[model samples]
Target: MVAVVVELLALQVPENGYGSINDAKVLAFGEMGFGIFGSFLVLTLFFKPLVCQQPNTDESFVFEFLQKMGLNPPKDYGFSGSFCSWRGVFCDDKGENVVGLEASGLGLSGVIPDTTIGKLIKLETLDLSSNRITALPSDFWSLGSIKKLNLSHNQITGSLSSNIGNFGRLESLDLSFNNFSGSIPEAVSSLSSLQALNLSHNGFESAIPTGIAQCRSLVAVDLSENSLNGSLPNGFGAALSQLKFLSLAGNEILGRASDFTGMKSIIYLNISGNQFKGSVVEVFEGPLEVIDLSRNQFQGHIAQVNFSSTFKWSNLLYLDLCENELSGEFFTDLIHAQNLKHLNLAYNRFTKQRFLQVDMLTNLEYLNLSGTNLIGEIPSNVSSLVSLRTLDLSENHLSNRIPPVLAKNLKVLDLSCNNLTGDIPLMLIGELHGMESFNFSYNNLSFCASQFSRETLEAAFIGSVNSCPIAANPDFFKRRAPKHRGLEIALVLTISMVCLLVGLLFLAFRCRRETRMWVVKQNSFREEQTISGPFSFQTDSTTWVADVKQATSVPVVIFEKPLLNFTFADLLSATSHFDRGTLLAEGRFGPVYGGLLPGGIHVAVKVLVHGSTMTDQEAARELEYLGRIKHPNLVPLTGYCLAGEQRIAIYDYMENGNLQNLLYDLPLGVQTTEDWSNDTWEDENNGIQNEATLVSWVRGLVRRNQALLAIDPKIRGTGPDAQMIEALKIGYLCTAETPSKRPSMQQVVGLLKDLEQITL
Candidate 1:
């Protein structure tokens, strides 16, 4: 059935924004209807041409399965096209048999159908992950030839039956992130060719199946976050020699260090959060890349030699020994694990020592030694961690100003709660233009608050730093934000200076055409040319594409004298060259990014998206016009930048997010009188707001009559309900479609005041 879809998706936006529906596609249709005489002639002239779907016997099963799933037409979808063309359905080499089917993460709900799925014996892979499916079809086990089956991240319950052995060819079977409980099935050991088994984050109880050792092909095993207890079977480790990744963390499994052995191929091992006691000596086999023994009862001093002997762990990259009862001095020369990049020894009782062995971990990117009891002058050579990105020495007794050269390329530096002393380093902060997070809280440090610009403080986590002298200064946040007039004056002076300089330069010799064009480019900022679509330029331009694939060379114009003279390059550098991590929000126009200008000024950069309808000149004009509207509550348009098709407007960043999001959070919709709910209201008071406990009585009760004034849940059903309704009435009147229905600002203000008084 050909039905029209009346979906009014575009909402009431501004005239410049709300798309024009008048530009509908001009479609013309031509249909030929056969007359009674023409039909007689066609019958005599020729036989009807054959028109039907190319037949495929194997596709019938899959087509029926999709029809049962009710996913075809969203409402009445049937296999109208070839079965191979269905979403998430894949065919074989000859395109005759459906081999793969995956509808994971598509919000599919309900249980699966057995008859249709059972007929698809040729299906090699089936993935229904991240759905609300609660159970599988009984006949689903008949797909014995399937190689991979994943029903993970669903609500699937019930124990896996011994019939799991039917899939003897299964290489990977993932049923994780579900409500499946009960003991591990012994039939799982029948799959001798199984490579990966993930039963983590489930309610699986009892011990690890001793029969699992029969799965000699198991290369990865994650049984963490379960209630599996008791010691592992004696031969479990020996049988998993080919295992590369093993996670038994977040369980009650108990085992001694000696009981685990002969897993040389294991690259990632996590036995943390278990009852794994005994010394860590000769524990891990050689060539382990990661070892996490944190939060366990591994007492006594670490042998140290096992983790730090040169040539011992040639491929070790991560080692975490935090939150354990182990106490000992760290190996001074950690050259044994030369490839180690992450080391955490926090919350341990290790004694103080000079940990300034800079040459040890030249490849280390993360080093956390918080509360490990290291004391003395900060390592002078600590600056040699050329690859270090994060260094957290918080909660230690180390006393000193932060090492200037330390973590030069660092993005996160945590030195809070230490015995640091002296003035905050301005040069260090200045050089740390790329720093994303810095913490110096609860320390003996003082500094002029103005030095830490808005961006710097924003970069610092809440309560990150302790006291700063400038924070108490009344003028700390009163720093000047360059005004629009300031840019105007600067533009004038720049043009005059360039003209004088060019005059002197042109007097030298015959100037080329490039030189003359360069002069036009210099004065082109004032020339509002409507260049459309994506363009590229360097140094300065009127508009640049919002999708900044490469570093932009556009000039950054400041509205006023900002704290620091930040250029486009500096902004790009602060935001990892405008990486996705820096993206704050995507709006109708373009995406907004958070950037740290020099002096730590946190600013929000709203890059306007350029479409075919809008040009560089129009965008520039729109931004300039919007920037001129200054009000008390308005977010200040701090500056603007243009390069090719990219037009960005920088504003004083509001930490709580922008206004557009707040409006969306309300989700205002028309609520007519007839559709009002008739149910008892429940206030925040803990009393029984409803009078009836019986279901019959509760069904008959009706809610109090109140207008549905959409407001944030934070203020919903509270005293603001009345106020919201009043304000919304005024808003609706102002945004009324008819000019005569719209009210003036004076009348709107009067109505709002009356509403306020009435509410009070």
Candidate 2:
């Protein structure tokens, strides 16, 4: 080897004298050893095409933008080619790219293919919500390392593009119920990492966009029902100071309810049916857990809204201001709403308020004041509403009695048209055990010494007075004298006067239990008669009277007759032993009793429960077309008792009960318009009392038509036939809202036979 390279250049001849081999330091040590082997062969051919241009360390780019939003990688997916083994892809751990995709409800439809989302330029998070995506391709906001965009309930329409604020790392934008209309974008208030914006029910109209107070990390804003009109944006409660759920319900927004007292970090505030008026007092401060200012036009006195501090509603739970015009003294600001659980102030005007200390709402479950103008009396401690399930003081103006502690755990009690008298109140038939529903129709209360059970007084009762003269009373031979006690007392008063003269020669076997009256001749039959009472049935001339003292407290005389052909075993034997002492009231449509029939008259029964085959065929076709119509403000049908499956109907029995126990039970200051005026019954019956003075005289004919001062004596009136009380106000307008507008019983017997020929 040339003498071993001449002894290795004489053992590298610079060993002893450092200056010799310095030819430019051996040409800089052979050009630094060929520049370290040509920089390791040009870094292995310049990183071998960047290690073959990366990618498969488990192919990611958010598994190609979740295979372009269609979310792939499932077949035997053990994906070591790691988008962390794909499947809703979420990478990171050297396998590079793709941060997260979420892929909710993934039945993903078309249109997200921008070369698998521009290879997810290191995407951070993109959740394709609900998915069936309609459009979104504008390079889909170039991702800009997106931070959370959920296109909710998609049908995604046009409008939203202010370059969608280029999603400057969007924090949470749901775009709710999508069909998005215009007027929201001001570049979505530069999203400063929007906290949670759900543009509800989209089609958003004017107002509301003060650029949404520039987001400022808003915490939840659901612009409800949209058509959003003006008022609300005065820095909308300090620009959403971390708001916690604010729903501007059914917007039309007419301001001034102090503009909702500065939102105070609202905890679910629903500006209900907005048209909001003044004096909503304290307008909320905080702690509210759900406040729906229903139907708004809010007038004063829900105790001037100062809800007894604790930030006004210390974690309140649902307080809906039903049909507002709110009046005062509702159980002292509704027992200060102690965490109330739904208390709808229905049709307000709350008069003479005395819910006799509503057991201070121990978490009341729902109490609606139906058609309110409330008068006192239901106070048997209202059975302390042990979480009452629903008790609507129907048509208020309450009365006395019928408060057998409200049938224990009443399920739905609606004391219809009240005035509530004696008789029918036998501790409401041994505490109605968890009653299901009950409504004492057009009351004056008299089921003639109640004692229910004939399958619970044929399911309860309806209308058509004195159950056919108490079933043509011979009084079952006076109850066979308690089954013949020593057969004496002059042979039981001569065998009950020879069984009441053989029950008046079978008075046609008691004319199927008499008392049926329907005398409408015509008066345009008063707006298709629905049912209040007084009698009518096209009367040219017809009089059937058997006065056993007017048939022992008659009332329960509804007779236009159709009640679904007829069944429930004919209302369990005409009320004979439906005698749980003949219960009396418990409402909503469940129990009301006092049936005597077999000729002793006095009937009032109503019972409705049995699960539901579509609400028992719509309450047996609305009580068989309201018992085959017949009017006089229509509350007739004085006959019906079926039994077996149970369904009883028989009305007529009102000695004044229900019109809410006579506006809450009379007594208090007792002036009720000078003790129920019509000139105090035209100075005690001289003018022969005419107008309908009950329900406290129609609340003094609607407080003398709003001139106020009608005070209360069961509405001191003796003048009603105003065309049969305006055709019984069309059964309160057929219970309003759906149910096909209600006037059917043959249009309520031709409008109560034209309101008895226009009240004759």
Candidate 3:
């Protein structure tokens, strides 16, 4: 666009109009550039009056829906001018009709206004992603002309309808990161025109529909991060001849490694985090550039490729098989993967004697072989990987002197917990100009008298160590405080003693402190128990967590006082010191992290947001009270830690997370009779208050023998309808407008137990 603008500017100037170009000519050219740029921007902006094309229908419904949803766009975005000129609305080339609407990430919530969009017959693309969109109008999918539809990262729910196949010209559909559940609708699989289909990060279950073979033109497909189980339908892989990217990771896809021999066009494939039970060798040769088969149960061996004939190893950029049980030879075909930039074979049973000639991978940027049982001396030619940016050989059995060449261009190096033994290579340590992270801990290597540089010591260590100069040893623990001048020490001691005396006298004369203790009298004997700990959750310091860390490992304050005396060290170990990858979700309060505590107790650690309204003590008391409230659906607060202003709460991590995320995503944009009655009043003329109103109407309609509103139609017939209706009744009653009218816990529990008998 800038180039186009520059071209236009160049054409607009009159060559040699000013016979001699000078300072004034240059200033005039600069002024003309700004004028031309402004004119171009104005031309691109939609203006209804430009072609005297006013909207034929009332589009005020969008604003009214936004207002009802308690959302208001910027002040400039409203009905003050032509509706066509409003933000996110794009007009056609003739400037006579709205062709596109991209009002995503504006914090808008609630169901899409049907009246507003139903009139946009010419709309070819619509994006309402990354908002709080809760529902969709009945005919939301009626925009048949829409080729690109993105309603991802929202709170939409309900089953996808077969009617979607009617969008024969649609090219891209992204409904990822929402709460939409149920299997991928067969109609979606039949969309031959679709180029990209992303249904990842939803609650979709069941197997990949066999009907997917009908989407012959699909180039990319992402159905990851769902509850989908069962093997992929046969002939599904063979049908996607044009597929360039395919991801079904983070699901329960059970099968042997899928046969992709028919997929000659395959470029990027990821089937990681599934239940595929077979050898990693099942992968077929292809023109692939990236492949990830990590975090699975594939074992035994991998395919030994004849890279020179069967495949182009130079085309492969990334190959990961980490966290699997695959063993046997590290194929020499890897030597042919000279163009590979990233490779991970960590946490596997690759018990190779030594990775010889690994330096042949000169183009490698990242390599991870940790926990791969690599024995013997380090690869002699390891330095040949000159392009290596990050290297991990930790948890190995390698024993050799530090390779000086490997340290030259490396930004990150990890050789921790290895069996290497020798004096530190002084020259190698001195040549690391780009070293950002370097760890040689837990090795048999001796420390040199020269000692490591200050920069190197500042880097973090991954494992326990004894020889490293920076590692904490007996000497470090026994180090004493430096002596002070005799007169200064005497003066400080005298003042401290005087203050102590004054405080003791004041407390004795003016204060009356109470102590609470639990005494157990048994066999004519008594035992006194009282918790006497340091008391100062009182200060309003911002750096409390840091201060607590400086004083102790962790300040864990139990709520119900479990028998296990867990400490900060426990949490640090459980979450790898709250590693970034363990973070589950971030809310206004703070980040919630997933942690695997000792004994396999999965927990969620919520580090409270700083500068919150609650004080340190008040937060503790509230947390303790909250810990007492337990329910099957509610996550129970296990404990809390308060250090100054820092507050951290612990809870049992729920597998499926919250109800809002489980029940609905922002906007599935589904239009079907299965989820709604035939007489449903989705038209704006009908009075619709909120989502609760829809649920209530459905409840009443179900009572009338109308179709039962279902979020998943596949579950219908496969399960008892009575239980489904019963569950719907419970949900509707719980959302009653009058809180007091809702059923009590005892009634709800009884109702649930009664309905459990009708399960499939």
Candidate 4:
């Protein structure tokens, strides 16, 4: 083109016909240059818009498409605006073309529109995951420039057409959790650029596609949860040398571990929940990070595998070979897997291996060897696992004592169905301060020490034959029992002893000590009364005695002050003669009932049944500490009623129920039937009075009534303080998990104060 222009200029110079040809050439050349410039300008004007149109208008199309797909763009973002500025969309500086689209969880339903998508010729990536869209249009394959495609967790159906093999630039393809069925087309082998393929959780049937092995660039293949049957294709491992994460779980692929030989880079392999049989030792090589060959019929002693020497699974964090027939010394090779965090060898016949060692696994957190026929006592060395949280040794032949040290830092301990005997150790109770669930059922445990003895422990061992003595030795029982068997003889001896001791020196000594203590207590009471002035004792002593009598078979005493005491009849009357209708709440501690005293005060009485080794003095201290502390949100303890073996504490009644009832109430769409008729009302009408209930109820009520009702009267005219309500919401949140997750009373107060200031 430059040469043509130069030739035209030379011709123009000659046509000028001047005496000085050089000057004529200059003038003609300048004119020719202007003409060429004009032509170029015209061409640009015709083609620039046609090829690279205004980015604003193109972006508007993208925005409209996303909105049509139910994606709400983030604030201040749109087409014509930088594509990179839009939510879930990315583009180059020119912003003239769409480069990427990652619209996930948008509730998008229906097929992707072809018109808008076809125009995005420059698109390099597209991810429309977790939507309701079904079926990718054939035109989608026209975007040959795409490198990544994710259409997971959608209702997308139908098989991948052969046209997908034409995407020469594609690297990653995720079509998981879809309804795509039928054999993977052989043409998929032509995608030389494919690096990762996730066809998991689909309906893909028929034999393992041999064509998949042709993709030499494949690094990860997840064909899990499918019906892909028949042995894996021959040389499948050799074909994809770089494969890392291969999961064929929940499939029908029948093969031995030897079938996975050539895949040396494989780090995560889960061929579990299938019919894959034979010794797992065949697949035991490489630097595996996670291996789950569970729920298979892999036979042979685990010792035969030689895992420690062959496979340096030092990086392995999760190892699950449960429900297999692999027997032999357990945890023998596990010492090398110091990094293992989750180990499950449950439901295996590990009979001869009486005890498994885990002291070396300092990082181990979850260890499950349940139903493994393990015998002998749990080793004391388990105390080394300071990071351990869950330990399941249930359904084993483990006899003798449970290690006291193992309870420390342990959260969930299941020793159920074991042959463990002897008294539950006191150190175990102390160590389990953070325990959430402690199951010792079907064990020969005589007693559990601590405050749990009277409630949780007693109830758990209700039908057991062994009598758990209060004291440590049988000699204590013999000394406490009556010496004579005859009733008349015992009565005569008792009368003779009383007559003989009436004027004895022992009686005088006892009187002197009693008088001294009485005087000291009297003085202390007077001093306290003077300092605080006269305060009314709202609860009646007589009511406490009467309620205690009806609640238990033994006699009881009620104390007006910390030092004063009265008899059993006072408790029964306070709780309306132990009426079942007065029951307030029941938990691991026992049942709490509503009580009205003669002084016209209402109290909540917690009655603990007798059986545990916890002493009455310990219960008193706990209740006392709870009573002295004051918090508006916390229920307050009043006093305690103690019987011969029964223990009860009193607290203020909370008219509104606990937080559990409020949040866990049945939500919309829960199935209802005649069998569950009685639970329906309780489930539906879960305390709607409190702020937590009000917020949850408001959300649900909006769906039910389709509108907000009058603002809850509790905060009416308070302008619906969003901040305060959200702060109060934390109280409800903390109670979501176990008592441990529930924040300390101090934290609860602080959170409430902060949330109280948020603007709506």
Q: In candidate 3, which residue pairs clash?
A: 133-666, 154-666, 155-665, 155-666, 156-665, 156-666, 156-667, 179-665, 281-303, 554-568
Candidate 3 stretches with Cα past 4 Å from truth are 1-87, 303-309, 427-436, 448-760
C-alpha TM-scores of all predictions: 0.54, 0.25, 0.57, 0.53
Write model 4 residue lDDT over 1-760, tens digit each, in one string. 5456455444533231211222222334465677666654454444332233233354655655665665544332333233456678787678666788877887788887765665677888989899899866657778888999999999988887888887888999999999998877788877898999999999998888788888889889899998888888888877777888889999888888878887878899899987778888767788788899998888887775565355885788999999887776674677878899999999876655667767678899999988888878889888888888899997788898866667367888888777888776667766555787776766767654434544565434432334445564454456533555577677989999988987587778855543332110011121111111111111223333443434443323233353333334556777666664565544445556787755566777876643134555455445544665656777777677556455777777766665434443334456555324223233435554433444444433332332225245677546754554443345333433223224445555555555555665
RMSD of each: 24.3, 30.0, 22.3, 24.1
Please list the residue runs of candidate 1 whose C-alpha ends up more than 4 Å from where it truly belongs after superposition: 1-58, 74-80, 85-87, 91-97, 303-312, 431-433, 453-760
Worst 10 residues of 2 by lDDT: 539-548
- Candidate 4 wrong stretches, greater than 4 Å: 1-61, 71-84, 307-310, 431-433, 449-760
Across residues 196-276, which tens digit of lDDT does each residue of candidate 3 receive? 999999999898888888889999999999999998778766888889899989999987765554677889989999977
What is the per-residue lDDT of model 1 for residues 1-760, given as tens digits with 9 covering 90 to 100?
A: 0111111212211222212333332121123233433443343233212112223355556654554665544323323445566667888988877788887776667777777677677888989888788888889888977888898899988787788988899999888888888888888888998999988888898888887899999999999888889889878878988998999999998887666577868888898888887677656565688889887777777636454232256587898978777777875435666788999988876777655465767899999888788787678676778899998987778787766567577888888666778766666666555786777666666654455666455334223343545446656455555677688789999999999999888765433322222210112111011111011011122223244543444457676663445567777776666665676765546556788888787898876655335654455546655775667899889787764556778888888876544433321244545433324565556444543343222221211112242344677777856667555445544443324334445555555656766553
What lDDT does candidate 1 reach at residue 601?
79
What overall lDDT, based on C-alpha atoms, would model 4 receive against the true structure? 0.66
Ranking by lDDT: 3, 4, 1, 2
**Span of ten consecutive residues with least summed lDDT in model 1:** 527-536
lDDT of 2 by residue, 1-760 (tens): 3343334334544321112222212223454565554544444444332123234332434344444556453333333333355566676667566677566776667666655654566666777788787777667777777777677887778677788887777887777887878777678877888788878887877787667787867878787887878776775676676787878888787786666565577788788887888666555667668878888788877664554254665367787878777777563555666767777878766666656355667777877877677676777776767777888887677777666566256677777666766555656644544567665656666564234444444334443134435454565535555555676677879999999999888885544333233232222222112132212222110121111122222223234532334332223334433433455554444446665444465667764434132333344445645664656765576664333244556677765555545443444335665354234323456332445434444433432232122323365354443654555454433442224333447556555655665542
lDDT score, residue 452, model 4?
52
Query: Could you tell me the lDDT of residue 74 within candidate 4?
Result: 32
